[model samples]
Target chain A: MNKRKVYIFLGFSFAYLAGMFSSDIKSYFIKEVYSTEYGNLVFKCDQAMREHFIAKQVVAAKPNAEHASSLMQAEIALIDCQDYDLARKKLLSFGLNEYDLIELSLRAIEEKSEDIRKVVEIHEIRYD
Target chain B: MKFDTIKPFLCALAVWFVFAYTYEAAYAGLRDNTLIDAGKHFIYSTSLTPIDPNIKKASLGSKLFEDVRLSFNGKMSCALCHIDKFGSSDGLRNSIGIGGEGEGSERLDSDGLVVPRNSLPLWGRGESDFQTFFWDGKVEKEGGKVRSQFGDYAPSNDPLTVAIHLPFVEIREMVNDDYEVKSSLKTESVKSAEKIYDRLLERVKENQEYVSAFDELYFLKLDEIEFIHIADAIKVFIQSKFRLQKTRFEKYVKQESVLSPDEVAGGLIFFGKGKCVSCHSGRHFTDFKYHSIPFVQAGFGKNGFGVDYGRFNVTHDPDDLYKFRTPPLTNVEKTAPYGHSGSALTMEEAVIYHFDPLRLISTENMTPLERSEFYKKLLASSEDSELIPYLDDDEVDTLILFLKTLSYEESSE
Candidate 1:
């Protein structure tokens, strides 16, 4: 292929990829925020079980070693409502809040990708 | 040929960008608007938040409520019964309406007929969850449409009726003698009502304060004010007055120092096994749903009068008979005598009434009220053991202490 033609093709491909992944990237940030929030509302009604759900969503959405450690810490804090401070600390470390998390969970409904779709289901059921 | 082909491609991209930006902006604006519009319904749709954010609708609705000339008698407005300071209801068993000659529940002529049902207190009815109106939950449809007694459901595209409490005015006593009487969608009584209604509607149109407020909130002209619009404005005012945030129970939980030893015990009973929290959950202290208990009827002393029969009457479901909406206990102290009939005179009696409710309790042994035929019947009923379980006197006192805590928080704004 000609050098100019090759560069143009690559540029167009990059832009299409950016456009396609925009919503997913947004969803990842949203899921993290809402999982933290659903944690808070559920914590009000029940702390231990809510923490379990919270940890599950966190691990599923961001399956890195750091998040896995935070997920474990959230589970430990679930023993009491006063332990909300501990849960808040984990959520803050991830840069998310309850309202942001709720909006993210709602935003996930618009995503059509299967991999993203699976993660959204786990987050939503845990949310409910 | 080369220029023509390039020009079409460039133009397509430009159009796509423009269309995409516009679509996104419109979608976002619509979402925010939905939240704002539905937020009113979440609280109470009574007050309108002005689109301009400068004009206040509650203040305007308040002014309209205080205007006496808005009535057929040219003397009574909403404020006559719902005096602001007096808990938004006259402290009468029933309120004098239209012609204000005697006390509520007194022998007053209404088209020569006496009024039925007590003047229910006005607190908490402004809460968005409260769609049921009158002593009976008779006016609201599933979609929040106004289904009047003689009129068809207002059109769906129309605004929701502002005030859900209009059925209170349809009683014969509230209407004038000369008001034209109609049987179908026609009649002289209906015509006269339509005229007075139009007069009230005209007053709203003429008042610069209301015209300005409604315009600011709805973005519509004064001449465009529909009955639903007025109702919405009035509803906003009513709800703004009584937000029902907390009660003594919540206070005790927050301010541990205020709780007495008995209140603490009652608190355990309330949340642990007393099962009150099952129905009385949330900050408003009610699930805002209905339940049936065996409590004997009170109020107007008419059978099935105070009994709600729950969503069944609204849906005609047989399982819902005698089921009434669980009353929020925010201002329960002021909205007595309790239950659908004003049956229980004191909180203790209300508790005792809830204990068994199958047998009648005597009013004499339980608490003191002015003696009347209704009072006499209650006095006789209060003594029945089947109606009230023999609580060790301390248990009774503790429960009452817990209940008093369910009032609006003293420190609340």
Candidate 2:
């Protein structure tokens, strides 16, 4: 081939190679960072923070016996640290796996936690 | 004139004719009377009964609506879930009841009982021809006979009055679901509800303000005050406060106001191609019928395990599975997070869910069980959803604009 023809052919080959391995080439240059440590810490912190907050709110609000019992049940479900056998049975009955149970429990806890915070706020307002 | 000489002028005239015809055809819904005529067939003026509520009774009812003393827990009231800021809704996905504290999102922070259903707004409720109540139509009137959980011993023949009787006796609403309440009250029986009413009446009678007001309004002595009287007073207050006010759409229909081009286009889509008029027909913008739209179920459902049977819970019919009453659209703009589960956060999403529910679903995030539940809902969806013609993004936006026209004037409210 002539010099111009050789250059043109080389350009096309280079373009084809780039197109073929673009994603892999990009991945080599740009690495995705994922910190399992940070994720695990966040998860643990959230669980602990919620539990402590719920405990403090319950004490401060001085909710009635019935409300206290109900709160206890919700807090138990929310924390998900204990009562594995109960959780497993409930999940089985609902035809759900552990992940689904965790999701549902967290959602229920979020709602309950919201309510607990409101009660504490009300108590503060009334006393203050 | 030579053929070449006349050709340019003839061509120009032809172009002008085509342009005019295209423009007219594109805007025919606005320029002509056909769209308005078609809209008239579906919509009518809100037929509100003129109510002159007795000052004393309505005042008492207003007080009672806010009074926590009516609840067994002394923490909940009708005002807690039905606030003015949310246009009579609590601004939560599911209403926090009995053990809940504060108002709106503030209630979410408390350990309050989650009601598992979105709070229905009070606008245009108990108005003329508005017969159904609740998302499941649990309290309804058919063939002039009021039907409710009360069965044969319905407290009042009036549907709204019977509906008013519910929250006061409902578990997790006003009454605590403790062993004492459950054992003493039998919770589900008519006798138990009657007993609870008597207890509430006694509490109301203890307050001198309520007693005097009841005496003035009903000519009943403090001892003679019944639970029915309380319901009637609250009904009067609701009727007076939340009655349907005239909307921009009403004014447009009455020839008092002119809608913008976008609004007109939206109105055309809503009544014509959107097929929204099928379920959202009549004066109050509801046929008061049940429909299943297959919206994403959020939180633990009414039947538990993230599955709500909706109207099937009431009728126990297989056809009624996943069906819910068509909610009245009055003040709909203010009541955000729509649907029976309050899953759709905006008006656009709610409207989109009606025809394109799967478009909003994230299949990657869903578990096997959730996917199975969604499949069941998809199967149970109404055939009416199929009737809606495909709308482009602009058409959907315009349709939302038309919905805004249905909003009552801020000053009027």
Candidate 3:
């Protein structure tokens, strides 16, 4: 095909693809806020239930040596929203202490953050 | 001097011949030596690991396990088919669940719906290695997520917990298949399953004993409780109660135990020439994968026309047709009749049926329809199948003996 014809075909393909996935793309850009209330959470009921179950499991887990409750609550927060920022805030609100540095490292590791490799060393350097 | 030297040389030559002949005969007598090497090979192939479950929660879960209220009809429980006496299976060629009375053989007389496949034993299912569940592997942990009939909305992250949702909601198994019953449960969506779970939770909570017990056990506020909680608890319970104990095979692997000559030979045949390890590999005695072996159809299958297209029922892919999950064989001797149909009466029969299914199927007994249906099953299973190597009678006996070494007596109490 000539460049003019190729451009026309590509334009149509782009339009079709965008039209097909407009809602999915919209959903991804928006920060997901799941609710336990049935009406609000209807479509994502399964996700809400799974989050709640994870919360229960966190609560049931054996306590670590120090700052365990805060760590546990952090884990629950993460399960609820899976938003690291939100979970970190929740953890801080629960009162981060000696476990904060390590707990943060755990979350960073779980999320596979680019800064994860030196997390433990950084924590020790900061705290020690 | 010459005569003396010749005599000595002849005597030495005669002694060496006799010694060589005796050594060959001794080697013939100790044919079981190969079996020891086979045992070593078997040990190299499989490893056994034990699990730790929350004792308090598992105890509470045990109560829920036997509670008949788990079913919508109040007719069935997990215990109905997974009887302790029958190697944690129903001891039927095919399970007859719901609308059934009595246990084992007497269940046949009931007006219950016959679930097409044989009741699978729960042995080694609680193990982490046993990542998939059910005959078709509808609920499986794959690609770092639980996949199931629930699709994107699988009830839980844990596949076993997700698998727990199936039995109670299944129409023919736990819920009555009647139109009224179906309508009562609402439509067959993930929402429909949630609605049933909600109702079942209410029913469970209504029992004061369960309410107090669960409240104390899970340390939960009453409203926080849900059906997946029940599933999780039962999952823990199964894990705790059925964790791999030191089987004779495990002990033999560790060099802390010994196998009889027959058992060693059988173990050899299983791991080596038998080719069973091709499908039934690893610690759980399963690769936790699916393959077709042309098992005979029993009762009405999941699909009408006396035909069930196994994994195809789940995936609808032509390649997956006639495939069933290779079942773990931890306690094979007791969990008979074997095969997906429970068609093989004895372990020997089950082993033999792998190679020669026609030997087990009584042509005289099968109706024209059954025979035709079975032939269709054969055709579907013929291509790209798990290879079932031929076993002689002694080898079959030895295999059964080896299987017995995998079992240990259990106390539900």
Candidate 1: tens digits of C-alpha lDDT, residues B1-413: 68887998999999989987896567444333332332222222244222221225667667766776666555566676665433455555444566665333342443223233445566666655555555445455456465544346342222224233253235333444343434332343445455556766786787787787778887879678865666666666666766565454443343332555556545544442233544555445555565554444443333334333434555477554555566656665665556654556666666666554434555464423323333333444343212122333455677567777666665663
True contacts kept of each: 0.00, 0.00, 0.00
CAPRI quality level assigned to candidate 2 from its DockQ score: incorrect
lDDT of 1 at A15: 93
> C-alpha displacement of A97 in model 1, angstroms?
58
Sorted on TM-score, highest at the top, how do the candidates line up? 2, 3, 1
Local accuracy of candidate 3 as per-residue lDDT tens digits, B1-413 = 68887998999999989987896556433434444444444334555465778898898789888988888788789889889788889889889988887789989998988887888877667777677999899889988899898989987888888887798888778888888766666577888888778888999888887777778878777788888889988998888876766677777766677777667657655654465665665566776777777667766777876677888988999888888888887777778878777767788777776777887778779889888877776776566342445555666787788889878745422
How much lDDT does candidate 3 score? 0.70
* lDDT tens digits, residue span B1-413, model 2: 79999999999999989987885566453332544664565677344466676676677788888888888877788999999989799888888899998989998899888888999999888576778999999999999999999999998899999999999998877888888896788647899888888888888989998888887888999779899998998888888788888889878877788888778767766765466776787788888888888788887889988889999999999999999999888888888879998998889999988878888889779878778878877777844433434555776898899899888888897
- Model 2 Cα RMSD, Å? 21.9
- Clash count, one per candidate: 31, 14, 0
Q: What is the TM-score of each candidate against the true structure?
A: 0.51, 0.71, 0.68
lDDT of 2: 0.76
Candidate 1 chain B minimal-lDDT segment of 10 residues:
B35-44
Q: Sorted on DockQ, highest at the top, how do the candidates line up?
A: 1, 2, 3
DockQ-derived CAPRI band for the predicted complex in model 3: incorrect
